[model samples]
Target: MKVLIIEDEKPAAKRLERLLLSYDDSIEVVAKLDSVKSVIDWFQTGKMLDLVFMDIQLADGLSFEVFDHVSITAPIIFTTAYDEYALKAFKVNSVAYLLKPVDDEDLSDAFAKLNTLKQAPETVNVTAVNSMDQIAAAMQMLTRQYKNRFVVKTGEHIRSIAVDEILFFFSREKATFCTLDQGKNYLLDYTLQQLIDMLDPTKFFQINRRFIISLRSVKDIISYSNSRLKIVLDHFSEQDVIVSRERVNEFKAWLDQ
Candidate 1:
């Protein structure tokens, strides 16, 4: 099978190429392109491709913009560091959504699903129509407001904390707590996952399963063991904050943005 890899990170693109080749020696990676502009230009060539492995957020813009300029009939397996784009990804020719640092098992499962779809060509048209509908819905969802503040009760006193004033949110013993700049901790009734969807992504990032840190909260970033990163936050020393290895790349990208 001839495949196209659209990823901004060269190391990641190379790693994915190696994984694809190792999975099936017969598979040939025809091209590797980064950025939305390059991908749109490549697709305009009218080259034949059996499959495509694409990244949602490219260097220039979102990969979804490519669909606006060209038509791609080949099945795509989206590889990304963020899960927020999962719903929008399926609105295209996406066959699977694999999180960054994709492993062999996930690749195998994606291919397995692709094979099944190949056997049932009758559903392709239906999928295409549904994909367009979902894209519209996903766009509408993006316009919704993100949480700007939180209300917390402290000993019969109610105080509203601006989201920006909170340094970070962490989960401990099955409860979520946000720490303020003045070193005050407030218990919140939302899970880490829920906070991720409600908080503005530009301001907050869920570095791991336990912590959702704001950009203003970052004090220092140090390299950690196993390609992970240790984050230092102000007034919070209850536990060490580490960025998961899989999320390191995305974390850096978020910081740069």
Candidate 2:
């Protein structure tokens, strides 16, 4: 009943551990790992694991990388927030998959499958073609976070700025600008929406289509009808920032957090 959990998110990993411990004390959680690199190291070190609750995305790379160079003896249960994974291929190999915000029913079902796997006869290795496809697809989706500082070119000089220095990304006159809390503005050669996607969601909130406001930029909020809200930013803006009726609840939750 030994198990390993490979998840990047701290909160998610903790929650999963708590749930598993709550479910059965007999299930021994051998290790909680964050990246493919570490997992490879663990294999090289010859760790004994009976089962794996693996996440597709990791800090360094995807979990598929573990399968690429090494044969995993333990069966894996794929856990992900999104359902874009190659599930058909996993099903062919008799691997179980679970989508996140995992509930009690899903957990119970996954455990049933786990128990069934122990009783079933051994099968052939996962198909080579499907494995190759999964690895390639994983590589395409794996991207590094913006760490330390990023460079911005201005005429003849390149300016290095820290990620925290960026206060807000806004589109004005069909061009995008990066404004700092110090009131310094720099024009970046990227769309506001694109910038929004690049930055961490926890750090930046898209107040509207044209504005990707930072956490510090949120100065105040006013309630509106139909569960809508209006937010004011510390940075200058004549245009009123309104949180859509659909997004107001989420906005309020985020604001509280």
lDDT of 2 by residue, 107-182 (tens): 7898886676566546344223236565455444444354445578778999987878877777889988877778
Worst 10 residues of 2 by lDDT: 121-130
- Please write out the lDDT profile of model 1 over residues 6-26, one tens digit for every residue: 999999999999999999999
Residue 70 in model 1: lDDT? 84
State which candidate has the highest lDDT: 1
TM-score of 2: 0.54
User: In model 1, which runs have C-alpha deviations exceeding 4 angstroms?
Assistant: 84-93, 124-130, 136-145, 150-160, 164-257
Residue-level error in angstroms, candidate 1, position 198:
5.7
